[model samples]
Target chain A: MTDCKLCSLEEYLKLIEHEEITYAQPHKPAIPGHVLMIPKQHVAIIEQIPDEEFGKMMVQANKVSMALFESLQAQGTNIIIQNGISAGQKDPHVCVHVIPRREEDGLNFLWVPKTLNEEEMSTIELRIKENLTVQLKPKEVEPPKPEKVTDDYLLKQLHRIP
Target chain B: MADMSPEQVEELKEKLKNMSPEELREFQKKQCIFCHIVAGRAQAKKVYEDEHCIGILDINPANPGHVLLLPKEHYAIMPQIPDKEIMHLGITAKKLSHALLRALHADGTNIFIANGVVAGQKAQHFMIHIIPRKEHDEVGIDIPEKLLSKQQLQQVKQHILPSIAKSLGARLQEQPVAVEQVSPKEQSAVPAPRHEPREVVIEDTPRKAQPKAPKKEHPKKDQTKDEDVTLDDIADLLGGS
Candidate 1:
């Protein structure tokens, strides 16, 4: 708690201050107009958040994004979170980074790559697909009909079919 | 839109000369549109809701099934949120990211935020974007990699490893959740044990003492920077914190 900078945001330079959530200009930033959105509490991560407040935070995040696109006229955006050390989280207090992007931002986050094999892909497909936001499955492709086959060819094929 | 009376305007002008950025931050939040959404005054195509946050469809989405998640209460940025709420948000986002991918049949998914204006934040309210990604979606998040020398990597690790360790608080320190050792699959299966940091210490002290004081107190001295403070540098500083 003593080390949590987010809980002590009042002591910092805030860009947008609210009763519960606070949007502050990050001292360090990845893009122009970069900002961090966080809760007023000292909880370290997102799951610890109450669902209602989490809802509000979600709203704020979107609104800010809309503003980025409209008010700031940003052509692109990338909102990212680094969870654990491996994921690149810097501090314990979880802050969402709202990055306004253009085609030329030359963005990089020390991202490492992993190549998923077919089995690994299927396993991931099984696990993460639960509670899908969109439930409609893609329709299967139909086999192509042979347009060149004339009535005689069809008759011949029919004889073979029997 | 600043609805102040002429006299109030004059008073505000009088205050403006001495007004701090902190005060202006409050003023901005009071007029924030998302705050209206949370308070039931505004309308949105909300997709998910719980005690902590609401997830709504993004009006300007990178792809279909894009979600904007926010807290019920307004806070400007990310650092102010308590660890538990942040943790909850992360967990919920993970679930939604999965759902978004399944629902949209997308090849991949991304969850991110523009933490500051330099990072592309427009609205002052805090939110997280859950975007479903496919090949050739062209979202433009492909950041080029800069390979560091072993010595430089060691220096960075030596500096930041401890700061991150301290954020674990007493609870995590005791259990020592080794993140590097946890595979992505294993982490997702039972996320709670991996996620549970020490709540008692955080909930009791800073939570109780969280400031709601008037803004005229602290002198705003941070240079409203327009420079590119890269993620790597921020990561390093945060690690060293």
Candidate 2:
């Protein structure tokens, strides 16, 4: 954790402290007014974080975006969270980019065209639809281990009492 | 640019096999410019910060006042993100969008996420792009016209509907869950964190939350200007644009 800079970014970035997350600027931003919203904890993935904490993270991101519009002369905005290395995530830390837009800023985020045929499109849509349907179940609470406090031990106590 | 050469794909795949999540995380930490900034090893033009996330200026932007929001912990990608964190991130992005409107008096805003390398993603970290928009902005989102015809769209819909229902659950089955505009106290209790935030986005002059449209782009950024720009606005923008 000590080696992970994300765990210790607060001192470096002049952050607006909050109850849940911190807001600051990116060192090498793709655009002006770029900012980063980081959770206070050292979580590697969203799934690993508690649901409520994750909720707080989103609240913080939305708040920062609102702040940008309120304080700066912003026109339009983009909020992006790249999830995986395959998804173009660079740092191990998770970041949401809230980019401000105006007429003709000319930053092309376009990718090379790879037109999917009808069959492929159908396939892809189906995949997303399928995956999107799956709900995230609440993690099951683990019972205490047998070594720590086993049902067998309780049974033995019950027999001894009888 | 999003497309990689065959060798590049092979190389990446090979790298994946050799790298454990921890090793990959460390590798990313080492090369992560954001982390270095958080560690005081580098510098940044900041915007704002709180306990959970950081907002900072983008050096290269599609428009002025662009901001990047990042989580303090290391999360590789979106699919890997838990549902709660996803919701949290989404809400924060919306507020930041509103912030840009209030502060800069910009026209409209766009929230973009390139999920994969093929989707124009260049960063290994998760980043949400909050961009302000004006009429006829040269920065084109460039989504091609309908990829499927009406009949095809129908077929795709039918194929996906069952799974969408199964996975998305209540949100899709019923009215959308209003995940935005949360007041602070409504938030749940959080323990002290291990990650410290870095970077800052200074508000030259802070403004209160207001619903007025931006001055630069005229006649309301969206047709429903007076109305609250709900999360659906972004979805509509992406769908209709």
Candidate 3:
């Protein structure tokens, strides 16, 4: 097994680096304006990423997509996340691919939609409903305040500790 | 309306162009079938629902448990969404991905968003497609490798880097002074200092060592010129005939 390239992140061209996420251009990109929003920490999959971290990535992705549209004059953009191995995830690290799309770009994300019977659809729906717990909400963006300890307060705390 | 004459399409496009943003949104909501589905006015097999988002099984699913997670409020594209709402939708997508894995026993999932008609965005309302995947399913979304020359990559970087920085900088300026002060890490990592071209080829050797990457299905279609899809096509999608 090889080391995760995203974790090192030394080689990739860095674009916008936030605390939780690093937006960069892939070394060997699928397209010219293709960029990736990757978590700073080594998170293996989307399910394992913290909600706040994932949220930050998505927000950055939107910003990047907007930039692609305005700056590159890209006609469209695709935000794609291949979550696990079976979904064509080349890297173990969770990275969101933001590709700038032009007309005749030769990249097609369109899939042949398969028609499922009523029974299958209903069964899958029931199963998904049973497993899904959808109460997860993004918490209000409040930066944690570190308590300021004055010199006098530290001295008093030291006396109390003794 | 898909069969509307080009002249009629032109007329509708003109009509859409004249409307205000608020009016455009209202018109979009009226035209969008997904908005109706989100509002519970139309029928869908909903798998999950909360205050901000709803998840329903895709009628013509790529896979068995394919889910379309949509925001309750109608938005035309991902960029139109506010930061808070986009976050909510993303977290919801993660949860739905988990649910698909747990319920369908699927091997993987793909979280997909197409922002314009050119990008395969069929509906006016923005939604996230969470397609459950298995081995050899043939829902080929494998991005073909199209490596850019170094100069081309640099040009792309030059174009995109400032745009992102400007957008983020504007947001940061609007934030509280304390919030901006806290992220010295972000301040240090801004794009200006990193403009020097570093050795990119050195890192290529390590990535090349990993040959165990899964074989992707390259569903080669005869490449067709689709430059006909214009912003008017987006307006047509928003009109939702």
| Global lDDT of each candidate | 0.54, 0.49, 0.74
Residue B194 lDDT, candidate 2, scale 0-100: 22
Tens-place lDDT per residue, model 1, A1-162, is 766777776333355445566665554455434557777777665546665676556555655555555423455555665433323455677676655555445564322223444454444334434353333245778999778856797788779984
Q: Over the stretch A1-162, how does candidate 2's per-residue lDDT look in tens digits? A: 777666676323323445545554444444444556666666654444565665555544545544444333344445555443433444566655655434454455663333334454344334322332332235679987777656687789788994
The most accurate candidate by lDDT is: 3
Q: Candidate 2, overall lDDT?
A: 0.49
Better of 2 and 3 by DockQ: 3
Best-performing candidate as measured by TM-score: 3
Q: Please give the ranking of all candidate structures by lDDT, highest first, separated by commas.
A: 3, 1, 2
Task: List the candidates ranked by TM-score, beginning with the highest.
Answer: 3, 1, 2
The CA lDDT at B114 in model 3 is 97
Prediction-by-prediction clash tally? 104, 168, 0
What are the runs in model 3 whose C-alpha is more than 4 Å off? A133-162, B3-14, B170-241
In terms of lDDT, the poorest run of 10 residues in model 2 chain A is A128-137
Local accuracy of candidate 2 as per-residue lDDT tens digits, B72-159? 5556555556656667666666556556655555565666764444345667766767665555545555322223233322322222
TM-score of chain A of 2: 0.68
